[model samples]
Structures are given as structure tokens and as C-alpha cells.
Target: MTAADWHARAAAITPRTELFIDGGFQPAASGERFDTVDPATGRVIAAVARGDAEDVDRAVRAARRAFERGDWSLAAPAERKRVLLAVADGIRSHADELALLDSIDGGKLITATRQVDVPGSAAILQWYAEATDKLYGQVAPVASPDLAIITREPLGVVGAVVPWNYPLETAIWKIAPALAAGNSVVLKPAEESPLSALRLAEIASAAGLPDGVLNVVTGFGVEAGAALGLHPDVDVIAFTGSTAVGSRFLEYASRGSIRPVWLECGGKSANLVFDDADDLDAVADAVIGGIFGCAGQVCSANSRLLVQRGILDGLTERVLERAAALTVGDPLDEATRMGPLVSARQRDRVAAHIASGRDEAELLLGGDALPGDGFFLAPTVFGSVPDDARIMREEIFGPVLAIAAFDTEEEAVARANASEYGLAASVFTSSIRRAQRVAPALRAGTVSVNTVDALDVTTPFGGVKQSGFGRDLSLHALDNYTALKTTWFAGA
Candidate 1:
């Protein structure tokens, strides 16, 4: 489609003004609400339900009822697959509308939201839908004729706290697998982005998802999010956010042993460049893409760069030039390369990290906030950075890349492994030997050699260390949300 046509179509997508709870769309029960503002213009885009602890309880109760009395859990696997497949088809039908909502709600480029996130979401849902019927219990051989065994059950209600970045995609990531595994959900969408989740309910209902099976309560982390995390009825709490908050949620859930938890958290991934690398300029751009894509909002963003001392200066110069060339403006504008952060608070946090870099490392380029109404931070880079600097250690969660020099593979491996966050890392050397050599030493859940973060919909995307635990986006994703059972039968 033409760019003009795409934008025009994106403009027509509906902007939902209410929250979906228990098969109904309504204003806040507390008579309170929050305004969603455009980070670019700082204008109130819309007012949405301001869910609280009470609302969380209400949602959880509904989910509990659905799981208990509802046919969802006890239904045949084929029946469950039918409903989930319908939900998946519903998502595909509303892809344009959902993408548009995401673009407006969180200020992501409409192209990305449309082409990548939305389609990716549909694929994820559909994949899980098919897997529902395929989920099986293993048969165990038993020697005794008197023994009989069987296994299979749902965890009941699940409380999912979705992050602002890739709101709809993240929600679908956990929700699809959970529901396919026969669990009802209470989705606590981030305050900054909740419109699409509301719309998802509509699509699901239209697709024939039963009442009370899936509910959403949009609110801040302190109220709805925390409540959902600690709710006694919630059998599982799947969260995607910071490491610190993940720890707190883990602690809260572990207190009673009532429910288990899964978290996908922070990262300071290392992207190493070798002197023998074939594509230095291309490598520079890939590095930038890995770090600055989605305005550097990703948890597994390649924020740490370790270039061999031989090519450090060259790579640094080229990367800085391209990063400076990035056009930071309205997400709706097709010409814009970088968009605003999720909120003003996010912008401020990124700014603080940039400022702190002055004391810990040499400022390379793009640190100061630009003169604009939007939450725009010029794509930033820091040089002469130690492997142990605060900028490298903390998840800045912005378009800030830190560059450090290393002389050998051992040094590069050491530097990359120094950070507590081992989410993802990349190597840019041309030699297969070099890639094979270094891939083992880098401490991360996933490593992409000769590329940045190229995620397959089928691969298990997750992290190790302080970056949080649990996998998403693959067969392994199902493993975390679903339980396994072994069936034993006695043969005479």
C-alpha cells in the first residue's frame, strides 16, 4: 500500500475510551479516571478507566468465576482450540485498527506497529490456538497392575501485568498461551497504554470468547498492577517490566505459595564488533537498530557496545553520524525515524542516565533533550565507558548506546559478562570461527552472531540473571504458562 493510504487508514482506526471487564465496557467503578496524553504534543488524547485495588478484585473475581463455573477449563481440547482460534482470527481482522491504536496510544511508528507488532501478535495467538489440542500428557509405564494414574488440570485464574512497550503484543504473548492452557486472565495493562487491550476484548467477544473468560483493568502499577500481582485467587502472575519490580512481584507472590510467577525484565545486552568484521558501516547501523529500535524501549535492547580497539574509532564515528541523522518527531508521520518515549517520566529517567554518564564515561554524542513538546531524547551515545559504569549496568530504556573498547576476545567476553543483566547479546565478526569462539563465553539467554536482535516468532525469547526469568514467543513460552502431567496405567 502507498504511504498516504496507510496513514489515512491508520487515522480511521478507532480509539477506545473505556475499559473491558467481565464482557462489558464501562467507566471506572471508583468514578475516577486517568487521561492518556500524547508524549509528542503533551495533549490529553483520551480519558480511560482508572482501575484500583477494588477494580482488580472485581476482575479477579470474575476470572475466578469463569474458571470455576465456566466450560473453558473442562472443555475438550478441540473446543478450547475453537475459541482460541476464533480469538486469533479476530486479531487478524482488526490488525489495522489495533496497530493504529498502538501507534497513537504509545507513540510508536505506525509502520512498525502495523507491519511487525500487530502481525506478530496474530501469529503468536494462532500458533497457540493450534497447540491447544496438541498439548498432551505423557504415558508412564508401570509394573504394578493395581496402580492407576492420570493427569491434567488448569491453574485457574491468571493475573498478567503487561508493560507499556509493545502493549498489545506483550499482552497477547502471555494471554494467548495462558488461555490456550485453560487459564482465565485478569490483564492489568500499563497506564500509559491500554486502548488496544480494551479493543482486544471486543475482537475476542466478536470471535466468541465467553463472558468473564478474559478481563482487563487498566491502571497504574501501584494499584491495579500490585493488587493483581498479589491477589489470592490469581494462580499465576506473568509480568514484563524492570528487574527491581519483578523481584518485588516475585516476593509478593512467593509469600503465600498460592500462585507461581513468571517475569521478563531488564537487559544491558552487549553487541561486539571485531576488526575483521566485513560490514563495519552496516554493523554500526545494526548496532543502532538493536539499541534505538522502538526508541530503545525494549528490555533486550543492545545498549552495551564492545568494539575491538582496532575498529573502535571507526565504528564509533559512523554510528554517531547515523544516530544524529535520525529524525525524532511524530510517530504518525511516516518520515519520522525515532518517536517519543512512552511518557514524560520515561524521558526524564533517560535524561538522568545521560547526565550521569558524564561522571562515569566520556559523552560521545546526543545526550541533551531536544526542543520539542514530545518526550524526545536525541539518540545518545557514550564512549570511553567502562564495562562496570552505571550507564552500562542499569537499563536506561532509551535510545542511549554506550561504547567501550576491548583488545581481545577474552577481554570482550569479560566485559560483556560483567553486567548482571544477561538478556541478549550480538557479535559482528565475519569469521565463523570467531563467532563460534565467542558465542559460548557471553552470558545471555540468546546470542545472535553477525546480526543484532532478529527474533523468530518460534524461538524462545527470554533472559537470564537479573534480566528476569521465563520464556516467551515459542514452544518454551507454553512451558512456563502450562503445566505438565504424567499418566501412569497398569498393564496386567
Candidate 2:
């Protein structure tokens, strides 16, 4: 569909203006509301219920009741699978509407929302649903008088807090596994982009999910989010956002029930391009896409570019050319290659990072904010950035790339691993030996050879160090939502 079509549809669909709790939409207890704006137009798209501590308390109580009732937590694995599959189908059926809502609310490209984000969200539900029935318990080899069985069981109440970027997809990353593991969930989506999540709650309810199984509380982190994180009844808290916020969740867990906190946080991933790389052009393309494809809003964005000194100039020139050519406009525009940042505050943050790079490195190209109504910043690149430059070290979370030239393999790996974040890294080289050697040497969680930001549902995605802990995508993610119990039988 055309951009105009999407814009019209987005305007036509009545915004869901209430908090989703216990399988229904309701206003906040205080009746307070906040407006969610379109970053592209700087206009309010909808007035969402401004949920607070009381709303979170209600949602948590609902989730706890659902878990204790055993309607979802003790259901047959196949039954849970059936409900999850129906949720996935519901998502697919409403793909266009969801995509449009995401574009308007988050300022992400409509193409990406339609083709990648919405589809990815549905696929996550389906994948976890299929894994439900396949989950198995292990029996320990014991002496004749004793029998030991290790089984996985759902944690009662899971509270998931996701970020604005890739909102729907990340929500699914947490919600899908939590539900498949037979745990009731209370999801708190980022306040900047909560529309899609509210819509998902509606979809899941329509797909036959029991009341209170999947609840969404929409509000600021300091209020509703804090309530969910600190709620004593919540068994686990899964968070995806900045390192600072993830740390807060950890503290909440410690101060409350001491429940486990799973975090998939920020990153400043390095994309290392060696001189021997066969396709400099392809490497250049990966560099552009890695940082700018999502306007560099991704938590695992490859914001650092480490290049061999021999090919540094050539690769830098090619990267400049591509970054210059990227089209930034309204997210609903079908031809837009990049969209505005999620909000004016985010745009200014990226701008501040670019300004810092100007003093610490050579501004290669595109370092200024564009003149427009939306929160648009030019795709920026910095050359000869110092090892200790703030732009190189900090998580800008925008379309800003820092390039540094290195001498040897040792220096490349050392410089790449020097950052506080070890979320993701990419190595572009032709030699199998180099790929094998460097991939293992990098401190990041997921290292890609000849590619940048390569991810799928089958592979686990996360980070370490300050980037935070815990996996998101694979079957291993279920570990965060479930607990292991060992049963012992003696002299049966």
C-alpha cells in the first residue's frame, strides 16, 4: 500500500485509549491520561490512559489471580500451544493495522513495520507455541531405591518491560515465552510507543487467551513500571532498554522478592572490516545498514566501525556515499529508507552525540539535524575517532557511526572489546581462519562473520557486561520464565 493509504488508515482506526487489564480495556483508577504523539508530525495520535502505581497494582493482582487459578499455568501443554497459535494467527490477520499503528506511534518505516516487525512478532508467538509441547523433563539415573526427576515449571507472574524501538517484536520476545511456559504476564511497553502493545492485548484476548493471562499497563517507567518491578507478587521481571533502567529493575528485584531479573540492554557493537575482505562494497553496505537501517535506534546497533589501516580510506569513502544517499522522511512514505527518531528528546540526544564527535574526530559526512517537522537527524559518520572518545564509548542509539583505524588483528580485537558493552559485534573478512579466530576473541555475546546485525528467531540475542544479561529469542529464553524443580522418590 502507498504511504497515503497507510496515513489514512492510521487516522481512521480509533486509538485504543484505555489500559488493558484482565482481558479488557479500562481507564486508569485516577482517570489521568497522556497523549502519544507522532514524531513525524509532532501531533498527538491518541490519548492513552496514564497508568500509575494503582493501575500496576490492579494488573499484578489480575495476573497473580490468573496464575493461581491454574487456568493458564496448569493447562495442558497442547492447550497452551493452541491458544498461543491463535494469538499468532490473530496478529497475522491484523498485520496491516498493527503495522500502521507502529509506524505512526514509533516513527519507524512502514516498510519495516509491515515486512519485518509485525511478521517477526507473529513468528515469535508461533515458534514458542510449537516449542511448548516439545518441552520435556529429565529423569536422573539413581540407585535402585531412589528416583530423581528434574522438571521445568512456570513461574507464577512475569512482568516484562520493553523499549520503544521494535516495540511489538520485543514485547513478543518476552510475552511469547512467558505464556508458552504457562505463566501469566503483565507487560509494560515504553510510554513513547504503547499503542501497538495495547492492540496486541486486544488481539490476544480475541484469540481466546483467558482473562488476566496477558495484561498491558501503559505509563511512564517511574510510576507503573516501578510498581510492576517492585511488586512482591511478581516472580520475574524481564526488561529491554538502557543499562541504567535495567539496573533499576535489578534493584527492584533485590529490594522486593529477590526474584530473578532478566535484562537485554544497550550496546555499542563494533563492525570490524579487514583489508583482506573480498567485497569492500558489501562490507560497506553492511556498515550502512548496521547503523542507519533502523536510524541506529536498535539496542544492538553497530555504532562502532573498526577498520584495518590499509583499507580505511576506501571503506570510509564508500560508507559516506551510502549514508549520504539514504532518504529520510515520513515513516509512512513507502520509499523512505529511514525515519525520524521516536521523539524530539531522542533526536536531541543523537544531535548531542554528533556534536561531541565533531570535537573528538573528523566529521566525515552528515552530522546535523535536518530541517523538518519531525525529529529527523542526518545519518552521520565520524572518521579517525580516538579510542577514548565519548562517541565511540557511549551508547548513542542513533544514526551515528564512529570509525577508527587499527594495525593488526590483535589491535582490532582489543579495540573492539574495549567498550563497556559486549552485546554484539561483526567481523568482515575473507579468511576462514580470521573469522574463526576473531569471532571467538570478541567479547560480545553474538558475533557475526561477514555480516552485521544478523539475527533470527532460532538464535539467542542478548549482551553482557553493562549491556545486561539474559537471552531473548531461542528456546533458552524460556529458562527466564520458568523454574526447575527436582523431585525425589525413595523406595517406591
Runs with alpha carbons beyond 4 Å of true place in candidate 1:
1-14, 144-152, 486-492
TM-score, one value per model: 0.95, 0.99
| Per-residue C-alpha lDDT of model 1 across residues 1-492, encoded as one tens digit per residue | 555676587556657766677788877779888998767668777888898888888888888888887688778889888988888888888888898788778988887998899988988888988988886665455566645454556788888888888989999998988888888889988899888999998888778787888999988898888888877778888889999889989888877556678888999998988899998889988987998899999998999999999998899999999998998887877788889998899999999999899899999888888787888888999999876688988899999999989998888898899888989999988899999989988889899988898687688888899988778887677666666565555456
Q: Tell me the deviation in Å of residue 422 in model 2.
A: 0.4
Model 2's alpha-carbon lDDT is 0.93
User: How many clashes show up in model 1?
Assistant: 1
Highest TM-score: which candidate?
2
Q: Put down candidate 2 lDDT per residue, 371-434, tens digits, no spaces.
A: 9788999899899999999999999999999999999999999999999999999999999999
